[model samples]
Target: MYKLQLKPADKMPKYKQIVQSFIADIERGVLKDGAQLPTITELSGEYDLARDTVEKAYRELRERGFLTSVQGKGYYVQAHGDTKLKILLVFNKLSSYKKLIYYAFIEALGDQATVDLQIHHYNAHLFQEIIERSLGKYNYYVVMPHFTLATSQEEYLKVLELIPAEELVLLDKDIPELNRQVPGVFQDFNRDIGGALDALAKELERYPRMTMILPSDDNYPVEIDRGFRQFCRYNDKQVAVKDNATDEVLTPGTAYVVVRETDLVELVKKVRQTSYLLGREIGIITFNETPLKELLNMTVITTDFEQMGRTAAQLILEKKRIKVKNPFYTIRRGSL
Candidate 1:
């Protein structure tokens, strides 16, 4: 029989102490593979614990794959302390900014957890399939739901219900339907964009006209467009919104706000083709920061992705269920 000393004053429950003792013994070689563990009644009587308490501990151990139950016999040790926390990380797509968040999460988690990342590519079907297949496999599920404009809130919430709310964390954008039910680390898109424009108020005066190149295909949050429009209207700044840059002409004293890197490249090529010098005659403000953007002298409005990842990891480690709005700022590099 295994002996465990339980403290009545201790915060941990008696059953948990027993479970930890078993694990410690297994890891220290005091308990070996196929070692028989005392029955629930025996353990309960020996430790002065309720039979249900001992049974609960044994159930948890078996569920965690540390022990196996033999029919009409007894429970035996199956494995030691080799269980690694498995996390399922689902993203819309693998972008540079997201890569920053991913690496930061890995660094924060260290070797105690393992992450399996998957991209749904903004497809609702794929997202559903991934979530359904990952229901019970992962101990934790971190999801970035970048649903399309056509995807309904019902569709998203339906699939999201597949995972237990306590074991899930929403990432990047927070949906209104879910409210504050689950913990999330999200960017306040509207406030961030509005704040960035406010920070660049003096610089924006150099350009008489401000144009934003927002792609219609990508499922960008509607808050971005709303924020941009509200800022321009409130400040009385002339603003034009474009879906693409194929036919748009670059003009002096005009600033271009680009969302996609491909559009930024197209705009830069057009500016280079023209006689207007970069940053001086044609101002550019791109969303999301990267090292290459710094080299290109592109001013950016971005959120602290690293900090978001760190906060998410902390929430998971501490088992906190709260919504957090990550920090955002404007990085001016002479582009605007």
Candidate 2:
């Protein structure tokens, strides 16, 4: 008998656990090609599972191209499920923070998916070309659409329209232009940054002036700009946007809100150059939490990148179509 490894302690649904067990067994060659799966009645009665649960697993197995149902005979394995699922990870760029999202995504999937990572380098043309050549080759298309080009929303949509909605998963920032019905795990930059700043407003009261360091690159979300401005207006505080990367002077009485790690390094360098102290003389707020940032006792306002990737993976595994807003918060360390 083929045993379905279903653990009550596991958070995954029972039907998915059953489906994953069959896929794992097929990969391990325990369930050979053309091997018959136990009937719903048999699994239900023997394993104390509901008939609907077993049926749902078998139904998904067939839908995912892992099994074939014969008219008279039972469901048979389809070529051991070796060609079942392949995913494409279309990212704008692989930064230190995004690597966390990527690793968490791959780790959560385990052997359930084969992923191909492609870097678009914030080029819309190249992003389109990569998608064009890889069409019909993957089971799912996971895209991080953060392009710096003047490419219209229609252009991105035109390219993405080629992929079926069932196989599309948007990640990170949402293209305000291509608001399709695709499911994904995304960050609400406006709400995220606004709320984080609100939580740190008391700490921010120490510094009379707050400056935001925004890079010209498309890697950072545009919504963040709107959020920062909104927060400043609401709080009626003195704030400045340092759009140029070359401007890295650490003001003693002013706090700096930096986005990119490169800018953070520059500010830290300035901090070391002079006697300006962090969290007190020079307040520092960086985006995205990292191991090193925490060790430095730096405050950060960011979303959970691990949850972003894991939720995206879960969407693919369960074939669910839902937009999940990743949890956002602040880690109030000494930097703030």
- Per-prediction count of colliding residue pairs? 0, 0
- Candidate 1 segments exceeding 4 Å error: 1-79
- Write the residue-wise lDDT of candidate 2 on 244-291 in tens digits: 546666667788888877778788878888987788899999888888
Clashing pairs in 1: none
TM-score of candidate 2 on Cα atoms, chains taken together: 0.73
lDDT (CA) per prediction:
0.85, 0.83
- Highest TM-score model number: 1
Model 2, runs deviating above 4 Å? 1-83, 175-179
How many collisions between residues are there in candidate 1? 0
List the pairs of residues colliding in candidate 2.
Answer: none
On the 0 to 100 scale, the lDDT of residue 213 in model 2 is 91
